[model samples]
Structures are given as structure tokens and as C-alpha cells.
Target: MTPRRIAFYAPLKPVDHPIPSGDRQMARLILRALEAIDPAEIGPVEVASGLRVYDGAGDPAAQARLSAAAAAECDRLLSLYAAEPARRPALWLSYHVYYKAPDLIGPAVAHALGIPYVVVEATRARKRLTGPWSAFAAAAESAIEQAALVLCVSARDRHAVEAYGPPDQQVAMLPPFLDLPPAIDRSETASPPRLLTVAMMRPGDKLASYRLLADSLSRLAAQPWTLDIVGDGSAAAEVSALFAPFGQRVRLLGARPPADLAAHYRAADLLVWPGLNEAFGMVYLEAQAHGVPVLAIDNAGTGTVIRDGVGGRLTGPTAQDYAAALSALLADPSSLHALGHRARAHVEAHHALPAAAQRLRGLLTGLMS
Candidate 1:
């Protein structure tokens, strides 16, 4: 059978971008899932374009410049695909389309090529329509309106997307997922229980998560547990300062590649992060894949990934509540291991790559026919 070619694009960050982030990680995972889905029926996905239309600062000037770049990219892609009919995709998939980073090129090129345009994670920020990000928000909304199907990542995202969805548009949830990691030994816990955190040291929310985590940990100082942080970024000094009081109890190993993280996940009992504003964190999935349970301040996004008493425990978004939750878990050492068992099982059954690939396959194949 001749393969049905698919074109993939990520305006926020390309899959091959050097930066390490949850958004980039999810983008990469979605690409892999697409490739893994029925190869005989779907051709190898092509990176449609490297041109980024991101305007994080919401500056009107930047949006104008990015809009021009997107227009030029569309012209270039239209010509290229026209020159080679076989290279033209049957479907176009754009990942992570939102106000901060809109799919300005995907919709235009897909419309011109007359292909079914699919969006993996499209967010609708109506509030941004009149804010500093008004121009980018308008472009994002326009691009979303043209999508044949929008695969939202969480229920929080699904509400707004479905509310604003066009009459013929389809909106479905494609939960965050990751390639399964090798099973952790789970038997090497003679020492104090190990806790892990893997997050970038960026300013704003990222730093805030770290600060809240630090405060939570302070309450558990009496408990016997060690924390290993695996990440680095611009606010490294601030993050380090936040955890400095712990002295030798906390270890910041700097940033590491995805592969290196498996060892840390395997050795840890719980992967803790106060996931403030996280849109279904990839690290939680990563940790659970390795049979390590997760602990996070519960919110719309974290709730999707962390199931209380199932995969892990969730607490109110206060330092005291989070600390108290951790204190209880530490008091009962066996409960941590028990949660770890459920954590691995939960991920294998729901969040594995194969599961995501199947969901994407069913959703996308239905569109083509």
C-alpha cells in the first residue's frame, strides 16, 4: 500500500531544538507516536517547516515580524509541495498551537494544499484577544478555526477548545504520554527513601514551583528522605538558594538528557514537584513509567496525571498541605513502595507510547476516510 504521507510542525519549539522543556518533550513524543502508528498506512512524518512563529513577549512588533515570516514560509512550502506532488502531505499535524506560539504557517499551507489539517494541542485564550497578545491570539484563533480536528491534552484545555470549536470541527483528548522506561528494581531502598524532581530553573512559574517545593520540604525535615534535582537554567542561582538550607540532604545534579533521567527515576521513591500551571507534566509520566510514584500540588493539569491514592498523592496548592502529605507518606515507608507499584501499572495501562500511538491512529485514520 502506498503510505499516506503526513507533515508535522511545532511552532513553539522544534523537536530537535537544543532546549529541554516539557512542551518540547511532548512535541517530540507526539511525533514519535505518529510515526509508530500503522506505518504501512502512514508514511514517515516529515518536518513540514522549521520556521517558528512564537512571540512570547506579546509585542505587536514581534507578532508582525513573525507573521511576515509565516507568510514567507507558507509561500515556500506551497511551492515545494506543488513541485513534488508525492511530497505533499495527505494530512498536516501541528503541535502546541496557542497564543504564545501560534500555527500561523500550518493552517495557511494546509488550506492551500487542500489537506486535512490536525492540531495535537490547540488552546483557546479568549482573554488574550484583547491583551498584549491580541495579535498573536487572533492568529492562533484563526489557525484553530481552520483545523479539521483538535486533540486536546487535558480536560482544562478541552473545555475552551470545544467551546470555540467550529461547527464541523472535532475535539478529543489525547492524554500526555511517554515511551515506557525500563522497570525500576524497586528493591534497593535500604537507605533513606529518595525523592526526585526534574524541572528547569527558569524564572516565573518554574522558579515558583521550586520555591513552593522548598517550603514543603522544610516541613518534612524531620522525616528521613533525600532529594535529587536534575535540571539547570537561567535561574539556577535562585533555585539553588531555595534548597540551600537543606545542605547535603539535597543534591542538584544539573541538567541531564532524557536517557540519563531513567536512572534517577528508577532509584527514587517519589517524583515530587509542585506543578504550578503545568499542562500535564511529562516528568510525572516519566517517573511513573519507571515505577516511581509522584507527589504534586493538585490542580487541573496535575490532576490529569497524578491520581490520588492510585498513581500518587495530590495535596492542596499550599506549602503546608503539600508538606503534610509528604510527611504522611514518609511515615509509612511501605505505602510509598505500594504506590510505586500502582504508579508503574497505571502508566503501562494508560500513558505508554503504544497507547498514545493507538489513540492518535484511531483519531487521525478516521479523519482521512
Candidate 2:
């Protein structure tokens, strides 16, 4: 049987973007997952959309211009595929769909091509329909409604996706995973308690997380821990100011490639980041896979990645609560070591590449059938 060909698109961020970010990393990971799977039943996949419209400012004019350009690109792709009788894609697979950046091209192209349309994380909040992102939100909802399947990563998104889903649309859980190698052997006592946080220094939630980290760590001034921050973005100046009070203890390493990040994770003891309104952070999974435990607040997305008290400690959203938890973990090295070990085992068993490839294969096969 011939495998179905899939045209992939990520309107928020292209997988090949030079910037190192969670969304780009996940987009690349999903592409790898789809390609790594046995294509006998699913299909060959290619990224078809490279439009980046998630400007964070919700600029209407910018959104409209990008939407127009994306529509034109859609026509170009349709014409290109039409010229090739044997190589036309049988389906369209969009990676991330939300109010800020939605699939403005895939739904129309897929419909005209008479192919199945699917989305990985189609986050929908009905309340966004009346805001500045109203047009984008409506487009996203229409795309989601036209999709044959919507694969949600977190329970938070699952609720919204299903709430606005078409009656015949399928909703499945595709928990976040990584194409990480096995955990290396590292002594828990070989180094000082090294805390690490890997996130973009963007405005809104990213900056808020930095603030939370600063506030929480301020109370633990006497604690002997070194923090290594591995990310950089437009909000660098503000984020730098937030951690300046920590003196030499906090090292801002800026952005790093995955290979460099993996080495840092191997040397680190704890992955501490206040995941404020995240979508199942890949950093937590990557850290856990490297035998490093995480400390974060329990939310819909972070909760899915960090198992409270098992893989990592999940505390209330208060800085005091987080600081207290961090202090307790630092005070007990043996417990932290045990937690790190469990974290590695948990990731290997559940969040590794093989598992994700299989899940994606099953999802794609189901859609094809």
C-alpha cells in the first residue's frame, strides 16, 4: 500500500528557524517523529508553511498582511502540487494553532485538494473571540472545526479544543516527548546544587516566570546554589535586571543549541523554572531525561510534564511557597538524588522518542484510514 503524503505547516514558527525556542524545537521534533515512524501506513511529510505571524503584540495590520501573503503562498503550493500528478499530498498536518497564530492557509488548501486536515495543538479560548485577536481567533476556530483530528498536548488545551470541536472531529492526547538519548551516569554529589532554567526571555509569561524566579530565590539568599539560565530574547534587558540582585550566583548563558543544552542538563542537579501558563514545557522533559529533577508550580501544562513530588516538586504559585520548597529540596541531597533518578526513569519510560513516534504513527494511521 502506498503511504499517504502529508504537507506539514507551523504558522507560528518554522521548524528551521535559527532561533532556539520551545515552539521551534517542538516543531522540529514533530517533523522528526513523523519521519522516524514507519511510513508504510501513515505518509511522507514535508513542511509547507513558513509564515511567522505570532508577534505577541496582536497588531491587526500585521496580522492582515501576513494572512494575505500566506493565502498567496497557499495558491502557489496548490498549483505546484497540481502540476505533479503522482506527488500530491494526501493530507495536511498543522503543528500549533492558537489565537495569535492560526492556520490561515492549510484549511483552504486541504479542502480544495480533497485531503484530510489535522492539527497538533489547536488551543481555543472562546473569550478571545472579542479581543484584539478576534480575527485570528475566528480563523483558528474555523480551521479547528474543519480539522479531522485535533491532537492536544495538555488537559488545559483539551478542554478548550473539545468545547469548540465539531461533532465528528477527533480529539486525541499526544503528550510532549523528545528525541533524547539515554541518561548519562552522573554523581549527585559531584557538584554543588546547580539550578538551571531554559526558557525564552520574552514578554508576558516568560518575563513573569523570570520575576517569579527572582522573587522566590531572593528569599533563599543564603542557600548555596548556582543558577544557569540558558535562553535569550527581546526581553533580555528586563530579565537581566530581575536576576541582577543574585550577584554572581545566577549566570545568564543566553540561547544555546540543543547539543550545548544537553551538556548543561547533564551537569545540572535541578531544573527550576516557574512555568507560568506553558503548554507542557519541553525543557522539563529534556531535563528529566538527563537525570535532572525539576521544581515548578503545578498548572495544567506544567503538571502534565512534572509529576509532583515524584519527578519534581510542584508547589503553589506563590514565591514563598516555591522558595520554601526549593529550600527543603536543597537541604536534603539524598532526596533530591532519588528524585533525579526517578525523573530520568519516568522520562525514559514515557517521554522518549520511540514512544512519541509510535503515538504519532498511530494518530496518523488512524487519520489515514
Candidate 3:
């Protein structure tokens, strides 16, 4: 018998999306893990649909349009499978399913084709049912209910999803993971301590994180440190202004691809980003994989990536507290280097791609039977 194909989809952003983001990176990493699985049994992992169903703005009008688009996509997929039965997939796996960007295409086609449907990095948002995202929210709820499994990337997302998911629906933990970057002989020059931040310049939670970062950096003005920011977006002007006061101390490198950012990661003494709403920041893993330490404010998501005194320091919420913690680290160079060494080891043990592949192999044991 021929190996059955596995269909992979990312509704928020296609795995091959042009822009570089944590979401796109995670989708790519998930595909990598799936490919790392027993490929002979799993078959080729294909991006089933490049149709992006994401609605950044919670506009009801956009949701309606996306609904129509999703319906058309479902129709296209069904017709394609009917014409080419051998090309039909045995399972459909979607990543990053939520109210804003739901897997509108997968569930319908999966149900029609009678294939097992699964979701990773799935979330449950009941409140959106009565808001501008009501239509999409309801659609998301239906898709989650139709899934054979919901592989949550964080404990917080799992708790929220499990509460509303069906009793029989399998919900499992798959910690956010990344492909460990190649080892770099970091030559941390004996200049002012270099602090790095890699995040998009967007509004909402991203903007909030940047604002908090600027405030925290204000407290470190007296200390000798150079900050390099690696990102760009609609709010680039605002992000630049926030760090303008620092002038020579800050260098905005615009946005960089993963390959280009490797050198920056190697040269930096510490990776600093508030990580306001992102519970699964892949950059944290990337930095750690390169043997670089990360510094972020304490929160649920921060806990997953950084452990205080282990990977790096997790400071209190307040800017004062964050600054004080950073200052202490800057004062103790030996401790900072030790933290970087530990951070790399921690990610290698817990968040590497091979570990995720093994977890997937175990979780998907009976999925097709």
C-alpha cells in the first residue's frame, strides 16, 4: 500500500508567507517536526491551502468576505480530491487556530473527505461570540469541536480550550518548539553590553510590549549598554521615536530574515523583549539555541521560555523592577555568561525539533486507525 499524505495548513499565515513573523516561523517549525516524523508512514507533509483566512481587524464585513472565501476554498479542495483520489490526504493538521484566524477550510473538507482533522496551537474564545468577531468565533468553535485533537502550545491556551472543547475531544500539550540554530562561536566584544530585541512594530499587544520596553530602558540610560532592534511594520515610525532619545545607543536594523539575524544573535550579550501577549516567542528559543540569554518581564508566556536564574532573569511587571533586575545582571558579568550557557542547554533539552517530533509520533499513534 502507498503511504498516505498529511495535509498541513496555517489559516493565519501560510507556512511560506513572505513576511517573517513568530506565527509564520512556528508554522514552519511545526511542518519541520511533522516531516521529521516517520515520513514513510506520514507521507509528504504538504501545505494543503495557501488561502489565508485571517482578519487582523475584527470587522464583521471582512469576516463575511473571509467566510465566502473559505467556502470557495473548501469547494476547490473537495473538487480537487474527487478528481485525484490518490492525492487526497489521510489527515489534516492546522496550526494557530483562533477567532481572529480560524481554520475555516480544513474542518469542512476534512468532514467531507472523512479524514482525521487535528489542530495545533488552537485556542477557545467564548467572549468573541457576542462581539464583532461573533461569526468567525462561532465558526472557530465549530471547527474545534470537529477536530480529533487540539495540540496546545502552552498551558494557558490548553486550559481555555479544554474548558469549552467537547468531553471526548483529545487535547494534548505540544510545547512551542524550534529547530536549534547552528552553534556560533559568539564573540561578545568588550564594548558596552549589547542588548537585542526582535519583535514586529505593530499596534495592539506588540506596540504595548515595545512601549513597556522603552520605559524599562529609560531606567538603564545611566548604564553603558547598546540596544539593537530587529523588526519593522506599520508602526515603525512610532517604534523608532520611542527609542530616539537613546540615539547612538540604539540601532534599528529594520526587519531581518532568520539567516541574517544569526550574526546579531551571536554578538548580543542578552535578548530583551517584554513579550507582552506572546506566550510562545520563537525568538526566545532562537536566542537560547545560539547560546544567548533572554530577559523578559514575568508572565504566563514568559514562564514557558525563560526561567529565572536558569535561562535568564524574569523580572517583575513594573519598569522599575525590570530595570533593577537588568542592572544587577549588567553588574555581574560572570552570572550573565553562566545564564547564557544554561539558556542554550535548557532549550536543547526541552524545545528542540527532535523532541517535538517524538511527541508528535506518540500523540499520533492511533490517529489514523
**Judged by lDDT, which candidate is best?**
1
lDDT of 1 by residue, 212-314 (tens): 9999999887889999999999999999999999999999999998778878887788889989998889888888878888999889899888889988998
How do the residues 317-356 of candidate 2 rate in per-residue lDDT, one tens digit apiece? 9899899999999899999989999998888887887788
Ten contiguous residues with the weakest lDDT in model 2: 183-192
* lDDT comparison, 1 vs 3, better candidate: 1
RMSD in order of candidates: 1.5, 1.5, 1.4
Residue 329, model 3, lDDT: 83
Candidate 2's error at 51, in angstroms?
2.3
Q: What is the Cα-based TM-score of model 1?
A: 0.96
Give all candidates' CA lDDT scores: 0.88, 0.87, 0.87
lDDT, candidate 2, at 166: 76
What would you estimate as the lDDT of candidate 3? 0.87
Q: Runs in model 1 with CA error above 4 Å?
A: 1-3, 188-190
